[model samples]
Target: MSAENEIVPPPGAAHRFAVVGMGATGVGVFVALVRSLVAGGRAAGAEVHIFETKERLGAGVAYSTPHDCHLLNMRASTMSVHPDDPDHFVRWLSAHPGAGPAVESEYVPRRLFAEYLQEFFEEALVEARQCGIKVRTHKSVVSDCREDARGVHLIAGLDHFVFGRVFLCLGDLPSTAYLEFTKLPTYVHSMWQGAGLETIAPDATVGILGTSLTAVDALLQLRGAGHRGAITCFSRRRALPKVQGPSVRYTLRHVTEENLGRLTDGFTRQLEFAEVAELFRRELEDGLGLAIDWKRVLARPAETFTHTLARDVERAERGQTLWYSILDATSEIVPLVWRTMSAGARASFMTEHLSIWSMFRHCMPLDNARRLLGMATDGAFTVASELSAVSYDEEDAVFQVSAGGTTHRVRWLVNATGTGFALDCSDSSLIQNMLMRGDITPHPLGGIDVDFDSLRVLRRDGSHSARAHYIGPLTRGVHFYTNSFETNLANAHSAVAAALN
Candidate 1:
């Protein structure tokens, strides 16, 4: 290592803390750490180190979009940085003139949300500083992290910092399935990275590899940039996410504490997928205040997917849907529900129902859904499933995508399948180094193996790490709703509380 790569702590530092990624998750973890330490009167002489390769501290890749067309999938009223303060974000937005439109029930631009996050972190940082906490921000990536008797050591760029406790808030990993197409000029492996889309011609035919929310982002960006090219989105299941409906509070009967206790006998045994399905079915019927056919709701014909979208859009417009509210309630308790499942059941759910569950549970805003409907009606966009293959023509500098027994030629292809969490294929050197040494193992479902309650990493030898914890999406194997902002913040609070206690 070079001379500049080495870092030394000041003499007699009392306690040291490190947050490995300063995105939204990292920011949440950092704030929780500050709050925990301060509440316990342990903030003095505490050193908190934040590591992030990017210049921005709080936005992360998801909310850092510069494009105005990209909007938050959920309404602003429901998004709050702190779990205790449900309306904190809404209050903040109301005070800011640049928050764009009304705070509640509006799909504001994601860039503005990034601004909110930045300002939120800064406000918390001010309080942390008042408590005499030493905050160090590093604009470098952590290459490796290891723990021993002394403490946890993080190696970033050339510097090494030792911490009493470390929180791994590493954000989304890149899409690993597109590794073979990384070198191709026509292939856009990640739409979140830089201004790659700006290079494509206005009229260039583009194909997106998935029909999830990420694909919607790319489509909106293309439209915003005045691209009139033919856009085709392909996936193994060509189902798009359901549209968000008017906000309503729902009473969750089957998914409640009492029902959960009856199922688990107060956390005694593992759960089956069938049991969970029953709970979901009951909750849906109860919330809708009607008994409905389960088959029609769960399984729609591929040709009728658009029709379903239109029907849901009408429900949303009429404010007659309580499904989104039920989704929100389920999201709040997902960790508990996920942990109840046996490993085999979790794996089965991942293989069989995750795609469909995600499509319905994680829907887009109604306005965006309307735009999609209009696009489909105008023949400006088409979706296909069973995406078998994609190949590039070097001579012609275009891509040939084969999906649903048809081939389409396009000048650009986007891998919008979203992030994958396989540890072996991770891009982070920190994760790779830890996985190589068996410091952390991959969960059978996906993401890092961890104790669901404490958020402590489970070692390759089947022991939990004392000085290290994970508090982000990587814990999704055990916490299936890790993608939601509310879930991530809640997990961060739990991790910080456990570490402090």
Candidate 2:
């Protein structure tokens, strides 16, 4: 059997699984599925295939950075890809005992994480060998998933292929949020892709449109690249993230790490956002025990509470108000909160709060990840509440942001505004064609719609079938908890169960 296309068939004696998007989540899914099959005493009767667009597995956009400076924000103590094996990465690090303390104890470079993932991938493949289960890796974009009375057709260009089961673990799409700011060469975008870096010179005055984790990575990458510019980042409020506690001694504390669970409550959010301004303020100021670490709150949602709270309010009253509350609480715990919202909720929340959320949550880290509150001595980057918009001065080689009714123009600009899943504007050709051909439809609220049980995409008439399955950020509308390590693992396990059952 060849390495890339090793499929053993003794008159359909083995089961098959093909997972798409070989990023961290996809790899986790593949490993979990193969691991299950390998352990089930039916390993020899299974065939698993992996497909990726970026040449290799493990490192997608997140870990694919070709730089040493870009390190994960989460410390070495908490960055394992496997939830069950918390120290899998720590153990991996122990292999090189003499690698040094700072590199060992602190957050190591993303490249190190990439290496760990690759190592795990190889280990899983080796283990699956005895069961005749092989991961056939195809280096091509999966264009669409077409289904008839039979199975599913994974279309990639003119080539037609088939997979018994498919999982879409597509990661972050292009940061085309501010497409309104066209015609400016200095408007650089994409912290991960590095697509807009070439348009800027050493001293090009720049303005980053949003302030999220992506913004933080971009700023660090720029400084590492020796970018000598007056880089003034603007959002709805210029709000930088609150630094992780314990780094510097604080006179007072808000939310501690222990119960990072409350951030997921829409009930709490609704009760908080009932009115404006102060109502929101008191909720966040409550306490650490009452609230949880922002990310943990995000990863583990208070869904029952949210559902109960949502039941009381009419659909119309729920959206912006509930969204504002979630956005306010989500400032410190963006990614995890992001993990919990349904694709529709994410689209709505992002649509309504993109400018506001970016202002408060997406902030540039400088001089040792200093919290913005520490440096706003004279209000250089202080908290301000306001509305903002984007307008272009094409000939001037600039893009302007009209925040609080003042048009601030910058030399270089790129639409770092983020992605639009309007079906037509997606970066994934597969997604675009899927929407175009009715293979998938947007959830009523927003994002790709799916059935509540199987996590499979729902058609236009809202019917559920087992032929198609989706995972990752796209299914935010259905699962609400897509793409986290847990979500990825759960989706894969569920997908495998659904397929095999």
TM for every model, in the order presented, reads 0.95, 0.72
Return the lDDT, model 2, position 41. 69
**After best superposition, candidate 1 residue 244: deviation in angstroms?**
1.2
**C-alpha lDDT (0 to 100) for residue 499 of candidate 1:** 90
What tens-digit string does per-residue lDDT give for candidate 2 at 131-174?
68866778877877776634566776576766556677777666
Error in Å for residue 250 of model 1 = 0.9
Q: Pick the candidate with the highest lDDT.
A: 1
Candidate 2 ranges with C-alpha deviation above 4 Å:
1-14, 96-99, 102-105, 180-189, 247-368, 371-387, 418-421, 481-483
Candidate 1, after superposition: displacement of residue 394 in Å? 3.3
Angstrom error of the Cα, residue 342, model 1: value is 1.4
Best by TM-score: 1
lDDT value for candidate 2?
A: 0.57
Looking at model 2, how many pairs of residues clash?
24
> Model 1: clashing residue pairs?
5-158
